[model samples]
Target: MPLTILTADRDLDDRAADAVPLPHAGADHWRRPYRPGPGRVGAAAVSLLLASFVLLSAVIIVAAGALPAAVICSGVAVLIIALALRFLRVGVWVSAHGLRQVELLRTTTLRWSEVAAVRTVQRPVRWLGLPRTVQGQALVVDRQGGSSLRTLVTDHNGDFLARPEAFERAADVLEAWAAEYRR
Candidate 1:
């Protein structure tokens, strides 16, 4: 099965925005659009490579008269394809309800009432025990220790460094909306 990112109801989001009192809430909602990012491209390449390897291995196993091995390889190939599809859809979606981080096989959703704070954290890109570069502006959500500091925007989902300005704006919207709704 191909991985599918659930698209929020735009009509509903618009309606919610009207009902809510947050600025830029209606027309300018935050969504992780399928933009061409390095992480996204890399994920595609890795998935393709794994799928190709599985196909070749399966062919070889069948030629060697190992039916069981061939079957296992086919299964692995299916899994690889599914994983790749999911990776393609990885993103964060924000609506009036709250936020949704779409992953390979799961989604983490936080309601507006559940959010305690939104903050930025700095991360380091390290190699051989040294920080060669720093990961700029990771947006985290604090659910008052319930979920600790959950990163809503990061390279893992093709946000943050991938689309810094958009990520920042989304983070601002989230924090402001949460604060307003909490009251």
Candidate 2:
């Protein structure tokens, strides 16, 4: 007698179809349409590097029999790592539920129903989220029944810095998503 193994016969699509859909309450439900630029990535990289050094110094301090100093260094390392994570998370995210603008210290979310229009405009936008501004295009979000225009994505932001084509494509995708979901 030959031993045989039995398995369910199903295609990939069938298995995928059977999977339960995830709830739209978190980052998993959102999509980033653009890539982070060198400035943001570089800052995060530098932060991680500093954290590594701090961790190494902590280890050395522990070997040198200074427990208190080692603990402090470890804490600093943890803070640096957190900062790097924050840098990585700063960006614009879109979904059927809404549009999200994530900053270093704040996040703003606008539902599709609240959005009046998402259009590209020629204006001065922050350079890499800096105080200094540069002449560029921005994806402005107009709220329903409001005169204030919220700037969502900018050509000079981390995602589209020095990438004009990517800015255009991302703006179009965001506009399309707004159009489709607003109805």
TM-score of each: 0.57, 0.80
Q: Which stretches of candidate 2 lie over 4 Å from their true place?
A: 1-28, 147-149
The sequence of per-residue lDDT tens digits that candidate 2 reaches over residues 47-92 is 9999999999999999999999999999999999998999888888
N/CA/C clash count, model 1: 0
Can you give the lDDT of residue 32 in candidate 2? 79
TM-score of 2: 0.80
The deviation in Å at residue 64 for candidate 1 is 4.5
Tens digits of per-residue lDDT for model 1, 1-183: 523344223323446556755575473465553343555667688888989999999999999999998999999998888888887767666666676777667888877677777766777432211335554556677785567544555533443344555555566766666666555
Each candidate's lDDT (Cα)? 0.65, 0.82
